[model samples]
Target chain A: MKSNTYKEYIAPVVVLVCICLVVTAALALVYGVTDPIIKKNSKATADKTRTELLKDADSFTEYKGKLVVEQPGAVYVKDVYVANNKAGFVATCVTKSFGGALTMMVGVDKEGKVTGVKVTNHADTPGLGTKDFEAGYLSQYKGIGELKATNVKDDGQIKFITGASVSGSAVHYGVYAALHQYKDMGGVK
Target chain B: MGKQSRLRILLNGLIKENPVLVLVLGTCPTLAVTTSVENGVGMGVSAMAVLVCSNIVISLLRNVIPDKVRIPCYIVVIAGFVTIVQLLLQAYVPALYASLGLFIPLIVVNCIILGRAEMFANKNTIFDSALDGIGMGLGFTFALFLMGSMRELLGNGTWLGIHVFDKFIPGMGIFNLAPGGFFSYAVIMAAVTYFAAKKGAK
Candidate 1:
């Protein structure tokens, strides 16, 4: 009975525990080596993106002001960064789309005019909803100073990609919220 | 197991017991990430790395691991290795890591890794098990590449982002969607099956 109990319970338990310990130690060792490199890569990507968006900006300073939260037309602003050279503000916004939340960055120059809009991350459906994210479709928002209404039907500022209106609206609203952030910040104060 | 030549064991995974084509393991990722050649190759290479590492470790522990808890032990080892791969990719190949996204973590549950652990690694020597992993990994990669090329070419009129027939013929947009994925998968599967049958008849 004693030997059977050991075989049935103790042996398996001890063996599993030992395997778990070794695996955990191995994971910790790899994590220690790679964690810093991962952090550095992401930071570098973010910096490069910001520079591309605001071409004249020498550097960016994260905006500490109250972030734009969920509202009627738009979702929420994820982050806002002010150009150190006073060129503009780059606002990251998350808005609802066909697939899920669509994250984008909108660059607004000092005159409250739009410089560029880029979708950074999105889960929009492939081939259908993704059509709205194409550069040609997003390029219409460039040089626009203000948005009285966010949707294409309301304002002719931005056109919707045919067969992907929901994703188009999501991209539109993302820029809407970003411009709102710029206005709220009173244009890079 | 020792009776079989090492070369045969390594090559078995290519066509005979190909994990994606013959065994039909890991169908989920096979369909989901094959929309583009880049994503397909990236996933295949990442999976191969994990498979080779896990098979060797599991074979080495086969004698010491108690039968009752072997499954759990295998999972822990596999998950650990998957996480290790994930970290390295995130660090060194951030673009691939971003494109793969959720699928990277999902590799932990991929049946091919666990299936090899249960079937080949437990019974075979470490060297042989490693060979099986390579063979199976290559088979999986080959299957994914074939599907990726077909879908990307017909669906998007491009291969690896280079436009193939955009000027003459517009891409059938449906090929990049779910229905297109299923269609391409079925066609490829049928071709592989037909070829295998002919080989067998001979």
Candidate 2:
């Protein structure tokens, strides 16, 4: 009876509970240290992208007022930055992409031409829709006077990624939305 | 019950019991990350670290773990090692952490780690268990690297994002797609099978 109680009831539970306690304690200790580093890494990446978007500008001053954009497929106009040297304005924007959401920075120069578009954060299908996020595709927005949805299939200039059309559309749409906000802020020039 | 040579135990996992090619385990990650050479190597090294650590831990505790709850205990232990690996990757190698995002967490469920713990670690000495983990991990790494190289070279005409073919011919776009991944995997699997069969015939 003692052996049965020890083997059947007490011992297995004790082992499992002990293992769980050790693992949980270990994970808690690790998370405490890594959380801060992860936060810093993400912040550094964001700062780098913002800088890239407005590379020529000496400084970028974010508009400290409420931003509300009621455009289709546009998530939000998260922030608007004006170049201190008056060279350009970069609007950080977000839109729903394939897997989750794509956040990008669209830079418009003094000529009202899109100087650059950079995808800052995204959770899209890796190879399919992600192809559109590449510089080759994103760079197509550079120097364009107006943000237009272009797909080679429709005889327009740009070609939507073959397999991930929805994701491709989302990125272009997000950039266009950011451009619209830039235009609202006195037409980039 | 009898003694097994350490070298034979180590070599057994490389080919005879290769986690990917022969044992046909952990195919999910093998396919998912093998899309690029860098990703494949990153994942392989990360998994190997977890595997070796878990093997040693499990072997050391083999006697104390109650038989009835050994599987659960093994999972908790493996998961601990996996989380540590993930945290280290995220903290120090954020580039790899970003590229391997989901796969890094998914290593917790990877059959190679759990299988080694159950089949080898629980029954073997710590040193031998570590060897098995390494051999199997390397074999898995080799299989993934070959797949990634073939796919990258053919699909993108590049190696590790550098232009390799230099417009010799436009890349076969399909190789970068899911169908391409499956096709390349099938080709590799067939080759491994064929060579293994020929060796067996001798």
Candidate 3:
């Protein structure tokens, strides 16, 4: 009678253990299969962003987490793109936002003038903050030299989109930080 | 377990026992990810797949499982299916995966999955449990889609990224913010409750 009870208890335990093992093995298999694809997709997105931000530049290099153009005597412009006769580098700034993160790729020439600013990613209030990306607003950053974070009335100012104060500040700070990085890398503005 | 009653099992999820509106289960994904129709649909479908498969498996093994260890066993089964859904989404529908983010992994903890396991799967036969799973999944999907549409329309003036009211309406971008999410959910719940009450008055 004791053996019968023991068998009854041990049988269920064995079955449960077996089930747990099988389920875990299946999960491992699925994770293994998808891991490669996820890595590839992430790389693709990064490459695309690099291409867009580095347009018109011959070659690009990553130095200290910033993409630097392979141009000679590149000057860093604060919120500006500086280009000479030959080649130039642009500063792309990224910042964390409400939803995800925001990336602004600012193209600078050898002359320390702003070529353009493109918003790469933004999860801001869809309509309001997203308007910051629209050409009408973003275009204002073009050809700007020595851009800085200040109110609209302040010097080296960029227009802030109405109802998107946080995003506006984030973009401003991103640009300023990128410019600082460029200056540290011997690019003058 | 009755063959004739299987239909009622499925129908219960759609109306009287709706997971989102009636039962108020799985509100995290329902509220957090329903900012857009595409995300809402993707999450809903993924959850449905996990729910149906897990429910069927649990029901089939119900008699074999000891009463003491039933909760842990149910969780393992549910987590197994959730992992499958998460991997599939990451591989085939990467965009959805990016949008859903951590919520995909959080599915393992979603109360709806556990609640269904305890309430229906533990007691019911496999067929009835499967039908219940499908019904509840659909109900959840319906609620998500409804909320997503409302939020997207007001926030971005679009549906599934397509401009719906470009000429006439000015999109209230605040609707896309977190506050907008809460407002939309409350309004939707109120409307659903109002209609449910009217129907019951008869």
Candidate 4:
């Protein structure tokens, strides 16, 4: 019985712990080698998306001053990039969609016109809320320089995606927040 | 196992005992990713890398791993490989990485990886275990591709996001949704099961 106990319990536990330690060491080495590459790739993608959203801008420079967010409620400006030649400003923004947070970059021109918007990260439900990030839904925001970002339900002229009011509203609020930051930083001038 | 039987062991994973169809394992990732062909391929290839690596490692350590703690030991090795694969994906193929997104990390929990590790890898030689991983992985990829192509063609009127059909009439929108995912999965599952049973009867 004592031998059985040793074999069944203590033996397995010892073997398993040794295996775990070895695996963990191996993983640490692989992670060390790959982590820098991963960091570089993330930066590359972020750069690519930022450039795509502000295509017409001659160049972009980071805006470090405080961004006044006129629109409150789940909207936030994570970073602001201003285009050279007073062209436009791109705001890396985030807001809550139906399923979760939607992170995007919104480019607004000096005339307060939206040049482009690209969703960088989102956890919205695939079919239900993610459709909001597609070209058809996002195109509505582009060049809608007239009204301050207001929900279409409030008669702001922009039509929210059908059956996905929360997701649509998230983008609307993100754009609204971006514009307020742009104005505060002399982007419209 | 003889050379011919060894060949049979590898072939077993591809169709006769396909992880996705015959065994009907790891159906969630299969269904969720088949919305688009690209996503399916990305998920399949990633899982394949992790599976092959983990399988070989487990097989090598099979004797050393005690039976009582085998499950935990297998999990640690599998998860380690998965994290490495994910890191590689994130670093090198950022596009594929983005498309696969949350599913990449979720691959750690995928039953097929641990299932193969426990069933085939621990019992087999290193070369055979590696072959099993490759065959199972390919079978999974093939199944996912078929489901993705059918769904994409019907649901979006596109193949790999290219608008191939429905220039006029819209495609079946339902195929892209959750219910559509289930219907597609069930239809394919039924087809495979039926054919396998027929072969058995014959």
> Residue by residue across A45-155, what tens digits does model 4's lDDT show?
777776787787777778878965543545689888787766777888888777577888888888888888888887653444567788788888888765554564664
Best model per DockQ: 4
Residue-wise C-alpha lDDT for candidate 3, range A61-125, written one tens digit per residue = 44444443322222222232333332556555656555556666766655556656677555553
Each prediction's TM-score against the native? 0.86, 0.84, 0.69, 0.85
Return the clash pairs for model 4, or none. Answer: none
Candidate 3 on B58-135: residue-level lDDT in tens?
999988887767888888888888778877877888776656544566578778889999999989878888898899
Q: lDDT tens string, model 2, B16-116? A: 77898778889887777776787777778778878989999999999989899999999899888888888878898988777766566768888999988
Residue-level error in angstroms, candidate 1, position B65: 2.3
A12 in model 4: Cα distance from truth in Å?
A: 3.5
- If ranked by TM-score, best first, what sequence of candidates would result? 1, 4, 2, 3
TM-score of chain B of each: 0.92, 0.89, 0.88, 0.92
Write the number of the candidate with greater lDDT, choosing between 3 and 4: 4
Each prediction's DockQ against the real complex = 0.52, 0.48, 0.26, 0.52
In candidate 1, what are the lDDT values of residues A8-112, reduced to their tens digit? Answer: 999999999988998899889989999999888877877787888789888899998888875744499988889988999888888988867778888889998
lDDT digits (tens) for residues A1-189 of candidate 2? 999999998999998999899899989999999999988997788667767876788877777765647454557778888888888888888887776767888887877788888887776535556778888888887887764452234425566668777777777766667767766776543
State the fnat of candidate 2 relative to the true structure.
0.55
Question: Lowest-lDDT window of 10 residues in candidate 3 chain A?
Answer: A69-78
